[model samples]
Target: MSSERAAVSALFLLNGLLVGGWSPRIPALMERLGIAESRAGLLVLCLGLGSITVMPLFGAMTARAGSRSAVWLAAWLTAPSLLWISLAPGFWSVAAAVFLFGGTMGGMDVAMNANAVAVERSRARAIMSSCHGFWSLGGVIGAGLGGIVLELAGELGQGLAVTAVFAAGLVWAGPRLLRDPPAPDQPRAPLRLPRSPLPFLLGIVALASMIPEGAILDWAAVYLQKEMGAPLSVAGWGFAGCAATMAVLRFAGDGLRNRFGAVRTMRISALTAMSGLAVAGFAPSAGVAIAGFALAGIGIANLMPIALSAAGNLPGMAAGVGLSVVTMMGYSGILLAPAAIGWLAESFSLGAIYLGLALLLLVPLAMSRLAAAADFGSDTAP
Candidate 1:
């Protein structure tokens, strides 16, 4: 790899690590502050709010600031938010921190994907999944280490302090690895509405596919604990298992695509997901349910990366536009679905909510063939 490619890849790796490290510490923060569980769940909304509200603006930002500058800003902002999360005492202060965290993460996500799209063009190959693979590895390491830190110190502030240091170090290294960005390829103008109908529809597909992942993140533990009688420690492993499977599958997806083609790969993945969720909702035993979650992970592994790869390859549109739309929709599922799941869980059984996630994914599964055939940037199906 070129030094620039190496540099950007390193940044992607670090991004995954930091995001992973932050997750396990969240419960400690909630306990430290005496916040209610529902309130804490609501706080997650702020992060999504930060990410979602500003996403469409990113293509414009890329035009104005260049991708590297945008990444630098995110790195600089992210550390302080981690620090704030550690220090904040009341609800609103922490809420502000969550908002900033989400916003910074949002910008970083868009910028990194933009960088990947650009870098892939320069390389003339599909390697986006590899970058995301590192992200999955980072999450694994971060979550594991965060568990250790929480156990050792029982202080969320200390954990954030550590995160801030690592984040700063990554930021310092970010500028070194950045590739020279292209000249502004589009005119700077009003952020007009998205012109492409297909990107928008694909975005819908992305959103529907992502809801199951969100459920695994936010509600898996609850279902395990409330419904299955698992201990707190074991309950978390529900999501951990799913994430681990996703990381591995995603890391291997490039090869999978190379072997099977994106379309067949997506169809197989969707089938795996649908079956996984069905098994998960009806899992009579804890072990069975966890397996189902892992299956879902394996199924979900490549959809986004493949979708983004396709979008980036679209003939008439800028890769940035296709990516931004697809990304926003995917993130919307992450941002918007947990609460809806919670409502369903309250009104119906947790099983019903999870099963609903499975049902929703069926739409994309049925349409996966359509998604495969549409001109997304390559001759490959799906």
Candidate 2:
């Protein structure tokens, strides 16, 4: 169990670091290509599109191959894709690279969570939140490192160089991950699409939770720099701070979920995220706004993990299939976030965009009860 846990944890950490490596450098990418917020969003959207395209297929493949083979294959592809993002010279080139990056990420995301789900069930306890906590910790470190690189050599040089190192590390660590628990030694039917609305309901919860979180990851620094007039070095702190808070909360989330149940846990989280986004939008200074982001981080921390856990445990659905569906939807929110926020920014202030996102939190707040109310463990066949 300990070895398996460590392997999954490593994958989570690598995924977070590879992805987080890009967040703090968004402004640099924009400046280098001389693109507007909206255009940058279109490029980012390609990444999301690629993920959406690949996730369901990857999920199906995970069902057939199990997670161990899927994890190694995805990790190999993801590492090079990160390096691709670092070195791309033009807008189209960057966009193309990121599309591949997102595709590989989709595969990794589903496999790792499916692996975690298997581990959790085998152990007969709660560990999903803590597993996600490692991802947040990696995010915090990666964002901080990117900020430092940005301050020194800017995006194309130091940022790319450092990220390449992290990507290489992921390749090295890929083989250490544990295999998915074995299937029953009996022939089974091939994988199929999940027909249950419960997964969709959980996916909606995931999608809503991801919107604010995605906005923070992609746009927080730009907000700090453009709206709040902060320097690049300091701009990344909002996300770093948010990731830090998320790491802490996620580390503690399992206990809270067990004690209070998913419904109450999600309710509190949504409200907290709402309050934080509202405060950040209205904040008077960069520091205050970062505080709000941190607050929002605490609010948004455990949502995806809880949603994925619920989906994986749904009785008849293949764990990978259910997790991939929710992940694809959740990542769609991430894919949409930049463009939506950018378009809204054109019509309104970034502050207004964030405030609007706060209101959007209500959907998840209302729907969170479905996870608790539904019988996730029913014996329905897939």
Candidate 3:
């Protein structure tokens, strides 16, 4: 069980490393392809579309093949997809590469989460949040070092470096992943969407929790630089602080959930996140704003993990199917909402956007009772 948990955590970390490593390279990729920002946004939309389109298919695949096979296949495919991005020659080629990247990454995400659920069930306790914490930690390392690598090694070199790391990591961790048996009675369908209200409501909660996180990832630095008059170096700290705090809290969250119960924990988390957004929106200085972002991170850290655990445990639903639905909905906020938020920021102010997201947190807070589904077996309180 411990080995399985560690392996799953490594998978989550590798997934996050790819995403974080890609973040700092976007500008350079755009320049290389001579694509404008508007077109780049459209290209990014392709990535999101690819992920959303394939999620259900991956879910079905996991159900039929077992998550272990799915995880290995997706992880192997991801390295080449990333390499393709570095080799892309034009806007269209880059868009295609990005789409493939998203699809493979999204597939692995579903497979890994499904496996995580299996691991948690085996232990009769909670490990989901700690797995996610490793992911957060990976993102911080990848993003923090990506710029340096890009400058020193160039795009291709950086791509090769990440690919090498993925390969090495897979060699170590892939064999250790929990072998989830394929559902004996699962239909051989190509896709299966969630048909119940419970999964739908849980998806909504995940979506609400993710939007503010997306906003912070995409705009926190700009807000700090423009609105709070921070230097460029310091401006970067907004997301950095948030990611760091999120990583820490995520590591701590499983214990918190075990102690407080999922429903109460989620309610408190929603309120804390709301408060963090309010603080960031109204903060008068960059330092204060970074602190607010960190606070928001603390609140946002465990939300998706808890929601996903609930989704995976839904009665009469296959773990892969339930997870795919919730992840598809939750990821839309991260992958698809940047453009809409940009438009809103242009129309109003980024501060207003933050506060608006703060208000949006109310939806998750109100619906937090749904998270009680995550508390199963030993997770139940006395």
lDDT of each: 0.69, 0.80, 0.81
TM-score of each: 0.87, 0.93, 0.91
> Which ranges of candidate 3 are over 4 A from the true structure?
27-38, 187-190, 221-236, 283-286, 377-382
Ranking by lDDT: 3, 2, 1
Error of 3 at 161 (Å): 2.4
Consecutive 10-residue window with the lowest summed lDDT within model 1: 373-382
lDDT of 3 by residue, 1-382 (tens): 4899999999998987787676566556656777544565566577777777777777888888888988889889887666898898888888899889888888888899988988888788888999899887877766557656777888788888888898888999988999988877675654546679888889999999988887776667567766788754465567777778889999999999989999998999899999999999988889889899889989999899999999988888888888988998988777677547655655677788898899998988999899988987227421
Best of the candidates, lDDT: 3
Note the residue pairs that clash in candidate 3: none
Candidate 2 wrongly placed segments (more than 4 Å) = 159-173, 181-192, 373-382
RMSD of each: 3.2, 2.9, 2.7
Q: What would the per-residue lDDT of candidate 1 be over residues 171-289, giving only the tens digit for each residue?
A: 56686755535335555555665686877777877788777877776677667767898755566566666767778898788777766777777788888888888888999977888
Against the true structure, whose TM-score is highest? Answer: 2
